[model samples]
Target: MVVVKSVSRHADVASATSELHMESGQIIRYVAPMTLDCAEMNEHQQVVMLAQEKRLLFGDVSEEAEKWAGVSDLCQAMDHIVEIEKETELFKGKRILEVGFCTGLPSVYALEHGAVEATLVCTDNDALNNYIKPTIRKNNVGKLVNYITCDIEQLREKFETNKFDIILAPELVNTKPEYFEQMHDMLKLALAHNGMIFFSGRTHYNSCDGSMSAMLDLMKSKKCFDIMERSTFNNSVRNETAPRKVVQLMHKMC
Candidate 1:
């Protein structure tokens, strides 16, 4: 026999009270929040109780789960950005451009961290206006962000040359080879003379045989940008063991 006590908040707890009799002779009480109905609360409680039993039957893997949770590409990118800010104050009062703004998290982070403004460019307007916009609004940085929906090739027509102080492309280099040419063009047209581009991607995806190397080669051949810093860190998310690399490139001086 197992005994588990579960507490839940509900708008009308008095009316939403329920009891569950498990096969293991466990009595689980569902305390509903003001927002949840009695039936919903009962169903929710069953899930919670089942999870608790599962952890009891099998050892809890919360620590292991947490260790991997912070190992995602997005998490790695955010950590790298934080490191850049600490070393260079890169986002302070800068005009930021974040390419591939799937979640728009980089732009939102920049605005909250001291960036004056950020322009988020992505091909998907639905995600920009729906998911990312709501989060920006919740962060109260809606006024500091501008959204642009277009492919990388259209960047020149969308903005004037030398418009951004820092261009962030988190995990942008892991794309198809054809996009690298367009990315190089965007860098030439959008980045200020002294501006920098900071991007990160998995090591395997950014090295030889990958599009990132090709992109860097293009920039170097053009004599338009110089690699400022490159570093790599290991990540073990989703069973992927490859190290992720972060690179910083600055516009070359004439």
Candidate 2:
């Protein structure tokens, strides 16, 4: 099995406990979402792809997203992310939406790293935002960088189809897969012409599962969507993880 590095983390809520003192540089506590730490952070190095190498060398934040909660091994999945960034037209300077903005890792990284400009409407089910200290520290207490604490299905009213440059569905297999279809419909409404949508999952989530190929085909069948890029990475987090089997995909409205 390949090895991925272990990310450092603490279990007690960083700021909510009220007993812990925060560092001056460290943003105060964040309202972490109720996201499951699905897979352990793989500290081991697998293979670095082109963009992966660049991001790691540059210390890009999205590459570091997997580390905050010990959920992903960015090193193993670098190829997929890099390809999505490079090939997808959806990632640059456009209004973007994040479906599961749990740790704010990828979402903030996307903003900081050029995936989008202006503000991104990030949505999550985390209830910590009301008392979220980091947002205060970041001065997003209630404006600009927005976060919605509602489920994707419930917040359909917040977005208009074809109104955004991009819409992203992160690794949501652990949640309801039906949301993917809804995202597709919403992206059509939310994304501009020639805009893009990125959808991802670890694969085989339900009993009636769809492979990456099947999912892409399904998207095509529904509308004229073009696949800008498709790639796979490793999941060497544990003995049970499939070797070189993680999949990531990017799509555009054709």
Candidate 3:
């Protein structure tokens, strides 16, 4: 049994608790919806809640989603990981750095499956810091993980060249669609020879302007990484609002 130390932020915020039962005989605790009334929620929170409620009517979050406290279209991300895992031997005893660690489950999943370590890159938010600390502890894999509260640009500067064996980047397009080329350069400096980068992106009607094919083409044109594998799927469970996501696995061309 894992005990989460109560944090001062949780007491201040209008937070609630939700439980996810995992297949590994563990109970993962996540922040349930905030206790705020509908009228009190910000526009983004309200929009996310409405979409989540719609998805709930179709199906509950999956086992992989349980690892991350039900954030985003994680099941589809896991499906993409599954495809890559079968084709490559990259996880075992390899060093991983994950940018956009929304809940940190992808890192956790990689560690649990035999990766040597996972460094989660994130912004320094009090609530999220409090949340991931316990989530890592709860999995009893805390020793295999590291957290850096900063953007990828700043985080890359602190690491040595060829330091990471695998890099996990999710939701980069939604974060900064214009900066893919710059981001690729920074990540390339930190990746080891033959290192792999797993990047996931999403696009929906009238929401995001780029298609998966276009994004892939742009990566190739940048001339840093060669595509290894690519997968796309409709994420109806976690993303009822934006149902399409693209997952790309790439490695240094040189």
Q: Give the candidate number with the greatest TM-score.
A: 3
**Cα shift from native, residue 162, model 3 (Å):** 5.4
Candidate 1: list runs displaced more than 4 Å. Answer: 1-85, 151-154, 205-210, 230-232, 235-241
lDDT of 1 by residue, 35-71 (tens): 2111222555656535543453344523222111212
**lDDT per residue, candidate 2, 40-113, as tens digits?**
23443223223333343344524223322222322223323544444433345766565532444344434433
Q: What is the lDDT of residue 29 in candidate 2?
A: 25
lDDT of 1 at 131: 47
Q: Rate the local accuracy (lDDT) of all candidates.
A: 0.54, 0.40, 0.54
RMSD in Å for model 1: 13.8
Model 1 TM? 0.61
lDDT of 2 at 188: 59
Q: After superposing candidate 2, which stretches have Cα over 4 Å from the reference?
A: 1-11, 16-92, 115-144, 149-157, 177-179, 206-214, 232-254
Ten-residue segment with the worst summed lDDT in candidate 3? 32-41
Report the error of model 3 at residue 248, Å.
2.7
Residues 39-71 of candidate 3: C-alpha lDDT, one tens digit per residue: 223656546655554553455433223223223
Worst 10 residues of 1 by lDDT: 31-40
TM-score of 2: 0.53
